[model samples]
Target: MRMNVKLSPEMERFIQGKVASGMYGSATEVIGDAIRRMQAEDERLQAWHVAVRVGEEELDRGEGLPYTPAALDEITEEAIRGMHGNAPACRDVLP
Candidate 1:
């Protein structure tokens, strides 16, 4: 699709720079890459919103756990162990 886009002087120079630097073949490629990145970011934000909603619903159903220093430490340790390719010590810490 061929569409005309109006850009400010700074934006025009930026696009030109991308092409001159051999990073992009043309202005179209540069704009297309930018739009694709924006779309990916939007999808990530949407996923976060869904996660927040699920968490809120869980809290409403009284499935929330109390925040404690011990719990935080355990979680941190588990995360670190997982990063190190070790199996989690406790699968079910909450009862």
Candidate 2:
């Protein structure tokens, strides 16, 4: 689809720079890439919202754990171990 887009001087320069630097073939490619990234970010935010709702429901059902310092330490340790590929899978920590 061919559509005309009006850009500010700065944005025009930015798109021109991308094409001149060989990072993008044209302004359309640059715009398309940006839109794709925005879509991915939107999806990520939606997933987070769903997770938050689930957590809230669990808390309402008295299924949530206490938020103690020890719990924080344990979660931090688990995250670090995960980065090193030495921890149990994330699902194993639930419940």
Candidate 3:
């Protein structure tokens, strides 16, 4: 498709250089790539928004279980069980 685009001189030169270096077939290809990146970023932002909404709803409904530990050893043991000696020592957490 033929489209008219007004670019700043610096942007035009950057696109021209990419085409000259064979990184992109033409200025349109570079613009298309930039548009694709913006779209992917938009999708990720949308997913994050949905996650935050779900978290907020859970908080509003008080849907959380409090953690109680009678011994520090239990906390350390639970944290270290799945770790292959590669994780930092767990700290005492209060809830």
Which candidate number has the best lDDT? 2
Q: Return the TM-score for each candidate structure.
A: 0.81, 0.86, 0.63
- State which candidate has the highest TM-score: 2
**Per-residue lDDT of model 3, residues 16-85, tens digit only:** 9999999999988999999999997787777778878988898899984455675566767876684767
Instruction: Give candidate 1 regions above 4 Å deviation.
Output: 86-95
- Model 2 residue pairs with clashes: none
TM-score of candidate 3 relative to the true fold: 0.63
TM-score of 2: 0.86
Model 2, span 53-77: residue lDDT tens: 9999999999999999999999999
- Root mean square deviation (Cα) for candidate 3: 8.6
For model 1, which pairs clash?
A: none
What's the distance in Å from true for residue 13, model 3? 1.3
* Candidate 3 residue pairs that clash: none
RMSD (Å) of each candidate, 1 decimal: 6.2, 4.3, 8.6
Better of 1 and 3 by lDDT: 1
